[model samples]
Target chain A: MESTANNRVIHVRELVKKFGDFVANDHLNFDVYAGEIFGFLGANGAGKTTAMKILCGLQRPSSGTIEVAGFDVYKQSDQIKKNIGYMSQRFSLYEDLTVKENFQFYGGIYGLSATEIKDRTRQMLESLQMTTSADMILRDIPLGWKQKLAFSVAMVHRPKIVFLDEPTGGVDPITRRQFWEMIYEAASKGVTVFVTTHYMDEAEYCNRISIMVDGRIEALDSPAALKAKYNAATMDEVFIRLARAGVRSMNG
Target chain B: MRIIFYILQKEFRQIFRDKVMLPIIIVIPMIQLFILSYTATFEIKNTRLSIVDQDKSTTSRALISKFSGSSFFTIASYETSYEDGMERIKTGTTDQLLVIGKDTEKKLSRKEEASVLLVTNAINGSAASLMNAYASGIINDFNRFILEDQGPAGAVPALIAVQSRHWYNPKLDYKTFMVPGILVLLVTLIGMFLSGMNIVKEKEKGTIEQINVTPIKKYQFMIGKLLPFWLLALFELMIGLAFARLVFSIPMEGSVVLLLGIASVYLLVVLGLGLLASTVSDTMQQAMFISWFFVVIFILMSGLFTPVESMPAWAQNLNRLNPVAYFIQINRMIMLKGSGFQEVSGLFVALCVYAAAILSIAVKRYKKTA
Candidate 1:
């Protein structure tokens, strides 16, 4: 399906991925517009990671036409890779490296100049209010700061889209809130945020969300629209309603 | 190029920062160099001997005294019977037994060649060979002494004078032979273990995923991963060489450049093995276990503790695939025998081939995508 939105940064249609006999992703179709916080939410093994991996060009789709950041996934994966950034669920940063060192490394790998790396690292540290911890090793820092730092490093190259796979898996409520604030801050700067999360409450923060159940997207709409369509008062109830109905359909 | 530097810097920092790994990389090799160089030897010392003399002759006693006087043999016991001496050999009380037949002295006086039976427990083949040589030398010396005593009244022309000398090692010091091989082990250990675990640690911590998403090409990433350990292994070789020179006084007969040149390529082969191991394993423990198995096998077949020429035919054939074996040969040739580049070119070319093959395989096996 052609994206109806004016600015469709990610247009994935009929995407399918298989691992031998098991289908990890089944005919996933979605349009994520530019400058939007798009939530790809699912439970464990619900294929959120599989689909996100395909989008990020980390896995080849069995069948699909995925155009990410204006580059085809099949023929232009290198281009797609150059235009996107990724943060995995485990908060992928070198524990032995200092925060400034992590920033310099990520920025350097992305082809930033020495001056650019120095400037960006300085700005990132100042923005995170981590100037005092500039030389502190990542393992010594708190988990919340590390999560935020991971995000900041991912966008150091100013890519067209950024993928965050469960950016806030284990953190306190306030830190999670602050982490989402950084996501909002990035999206506000015209960087499309494609995030995956299992947290139902976190799903409410996305501009539009897709709830996956058993390799299929069961619900794709705004949080209000999903609640209204399922006749539920919250995103959590909407998720349960769709997930249960999905299981019933599979069984029937 | 810059990306490679970043990766190299990160790896060096992590390698130096880990408290446990730092000591293991630096201290273990040095300590092993000292300990293994001292302990691993083919020199036969204090070989226990048991004698059973049935003739009760002066000649028999003279032979026994000759053996007993040598520093290599100790007269552990004098059994009354051959069966008792055999029993002593079985019980580990003695390594060898000499049984003198009853007619041994009578035949010698009658101008007939006498016969005596010698028995040895040849559990260790190399040590047994050395023992045989030492015992034979003593018996020959006794034979000459008897010849002079019997025929000195009339002057006789000597038969022949056979001049022999050990060339490279005149003293036949086991330390000289062992120290170079131990240095090869130090390089192999550092090159394989450190490089293997470095890649696997990123994988275990999920940092590899972050690296995979970057624009770092496969070869660039691999070179970045391997370069630090290669240099580090060379640094280790330098230290080990210094220790060999200062402590063991092993001669550095060949050019230092030639040794480092072979060592550099040899390190590539080992570091490539490490990267290949890392690519196949999912965790640091798995990487370590896999590399450890290969390291032990390679070191054993490497002609370090034993000559590769002396191994079984199939094992010698297998050494063609072992990089450590080639390196041990190269190091010993350069340090001990003063072999030049042209002399070791066959091994050098084989190592170059191995380095290329293993590194390319490592690069190909490392999956940037899931």
Candidate 2:
């Protein structure tokens, strides 16, 4: 892990995002190393999604020097988009399309050859044990299966980084565990995972996590280290301590 | 280019899979064409006429026979009193009243003019005017007949005659004029609504975000979004043209290829407008309302139901910005008059410029980042 620490996939310096007078991400600074699962945790409207959007090149920051997959978010956003994959919580896959068709379409747009797409699609379906359901329309599938398929489709292009925005929001805990396993597998293959979530238990699965409070990162380190520093029993307690401080600042 | 191909493939698949949308794209326009072409017309076949004949003479009887014999007027009743004839018109039972004055023949024989009164229901202004024209024409023919009969062969005063001929449509079949214009309308409807709703649907479904985050070029995505509807609209125009030719037997005097070429360019303008509407709107409902607002304005001002020549000068000036008006005019000229490319070259250039301008605006407005 120490040997791979020098390979920085995401670098941010003094990132400031303002929607009118309200700053969504204020002077944020962070770096995500290669093959690392970086968890972004925040309560609702804490600006986690906004920060993730900026990192994915889905939005332009009001002011920032940010980079994703070694490409500058401002100048090389198109190149950054090519190297990164994104899946939102809104279920972005086409419900009318079949599982295999979704995979082929996402792969094809990324300039993958037809045979390569077919091979990867078959491999993905077989691994997910969804081979028989490949031809089934996506709308008929269960929500958990759809979530899994969306993540796999996001990886169909073999992007260097995958941005999952609340990828397991509505899924069962068992399914979320499986989702984490998939994320770990991708990370093992040197695909950096940038995921945002509300579940503190899920944050424990990250090698290192950042807890954002009121548009700023209040704490960022390994979950065990954050718990130890806060003198808390679990990540949940650490999160509560930081979030209460954010609440105090709001009232002040 | 390959990316565009895949996007088109995905879009075509989704469109075909929607059973509700498929029929709307293909069947509804044809139904509108068949119904509107027949129902929306200017030809007044039956105008009920009542006669108040006070003069019981050969001249008056001959005139009554003239009104009854003509196909334009159906004599609803014959009354002794003028009030009774007018009552038929007031009650909506008759469209016009023809009153023959007393001693009309006696006055004509004395080489003096005889006056007859025609009271027309001017409720519907244009229809009333047409009925008036037909009645006056028949009365003129009667005067000419009386002149030829009463005077010596060469002693009749010489009068300048106006022989009017209706060209392009010799028989003045209304469908020949209407079908081309309606065809332009249906094509515009399909192009504008489908392409506009399509992009907004992707936005609503959150699929647009997925496509946006990809490395796909903006032009490639736009082309993918628009080309399928463009082809579908052109195909619809072809089917409409075939229906026009076969069912109505509307004369296609112009080159089919030229009409289609012009239609293709016109479709770009319409499709671009739809795409533009999609970019500004978030939901399919908003896009539909925006499209409806524009479509209603364009259709009314398109000269489809009324002649542009008769429109107020300000409206005519405003119509210079109307793409539908330009295309309908081009369609009528080509299909009815057999106009060549050279004849419509100026309008063709205008359409080209409009297409380029509208499409670029749509492209520019569609923000990938947003």
Candidate 3:
């Protein structure tokens, strides 16, 4: 079979995932294009995380197709791993390590040279304007700084796609704004952003958002268009309207 | 090349950053190795004896002088009479009392035998038995010379006589027997305890997330963790040995290299046990508890104080499972028997099998789990 290079960084078709007869994802389909902020907007237990786990090669899909960054997730998992970065909700980084050390550890894992890590760290610390705290341990830092530092470490390798599983799950608006700025910087560098989040305002920042309902993508489009099409004022309103329609559609 | 160094540097930095747990990594083992080695012994102490002399003759006095001159006892007190010595036995302070009755010298001259009175404190029974044995042995030696007419030449007066010699350590001070085995137990237990828990801590703390997703192979990561601790165990062994040499003046009778060679194999088995433990544990605290539980068993079964043969037959069989047991045998064989590899191969092979089996299982488990 021939492979096509598309603007889509991730292409899924009829993705079925089961957990011992419990269908977590039922025929899920979505496309995340390159250099775009793809918001996985879904309610709790709507299979958004399940689909993301499959995309990240954490869990095997029961049956269906998954193409992440020109690599088949099932067959070319190692290749998929090389071309992407993953950060979990808990912000997986050595807490005992300093900000610079965490950066070095992650960079080393991704096969970057020490010089590259040093230069990149300089750039990251310079952009954050927190050069003085480069050597400050991550556990000692505030949660806001920790969030930003985690994002920086995840993007340290500059992979084609970065998976942020609710990267800012619990943080204030200012910290959330700073986090999105870091995401924006990564996306501007032509890195595709596949992020899962509960915040409606953050969903608005995505170029395209997919609202999952009952293990399927109920709506996938720009927030403005989804809101306008549903005659709703915001993505939250659009989500509620689509969720209701999705229920009624199921009933019908 | 640079990447592995970066990871190594980060790990070392983190190990040092935890200021509280850091010094314990080095100093605790050293202090323990030095202090505890002195405690691991088979030598019995604080024996008490009561003497009653009814025959106040010079010969009786000369015989009593032999007991008081020895270092094994503190002659608790001298009873005025036989009844008093028997009374001293009830309180258990004196494990045994010797009563020499009147006409003790006349009975020997007349070729008629006279029995000595030996009152024993049976409360702490084993000490009483050993004390009686020593007292009887010294009296028997005195009787062989003084009571018999054969004089000094009687032992070798016969034409067909044999001479014997003592080897390795003739004196066989309990400290010489103890030092090597203690070195094995401490090194094996500490290495197993600390190194096994090291990776388990990383796994619990989620530092392993970076390691698992990295291009570094499982074997490399496992080696990097285990090797430093293996070396540390040996370092402690060397330090303990040096202290034993300088302070206790223990003679290394056998080949030091052979002892170390067997010890190195024994260390592999212990380190493998540690790795197996780490593979099973999910937290440092759990690893610590599990290691301590094994250490207790290891010390008991290693024959650090008592002979493995002297234990129950089932316990002797159980001791075969303990790697520390083989190390102790190898240590004593090398240090006391001055034995070669030929004499110690059985223990070395047992340790080899344990090392290979445990290390293989641990590596497989780590790869599958981590």
Docking class of 1: medium
Winner on lDDT (1 vs 3): 1
Ranking by lDDT: 2, 1, 3
Least well predicted 10-residue stretch by lDDT in candidate 1 chain B: B150-159
Pairwise TM-score winner, candidates 2 and 3: 2
Model 2 spans with C-alpha error above 4 angstroms: A3-5, A244-252, B56-58, B77-91
Residue-wise lDDT of candidate 2 within B1-370, one digit each (tens)?
8888899899999989999989988899899989988999998867898898889999999988888899988888888899998878889898999999999999999999889999999999999999999999999999898999999989788989998899999888888889999999999999999999989998999998898889999888888999999999999999999999999999999999999999999999999999999999999999999999999999999999888899999999999889999999999999999999999999999999999999999999999888
Error at B157, model 3, angstroms = 12
- DockQ of predicted candidate 1: 0.75
Candidate 1, pairs of clashing residues: none
* lDDT (tens digit, per residue) of candidate 3 on B87-165: 7777666777888889887776676786677776766566567776777767776765564453455553444435656
Question: Tens digits of per-residue lDDT for model 1 on A152-197?
Answer: 9889999889999998888889999999999999888888999998
**Which regions of candidate 1 deviate over 4 angstroms?**
A1-6, A245-252, B55-57, B102-107, B153-161
Candidate with the greatest DockQ versus the true structure: 2
Clashing pairs in 3: none
Which residue pairs clash in candidate 2? none
| Each prediction's number of clashing residue pairs | 0, 0, 0
Each prediction's whole-model lDDT (CA): 0.88, 0.92, 0.78
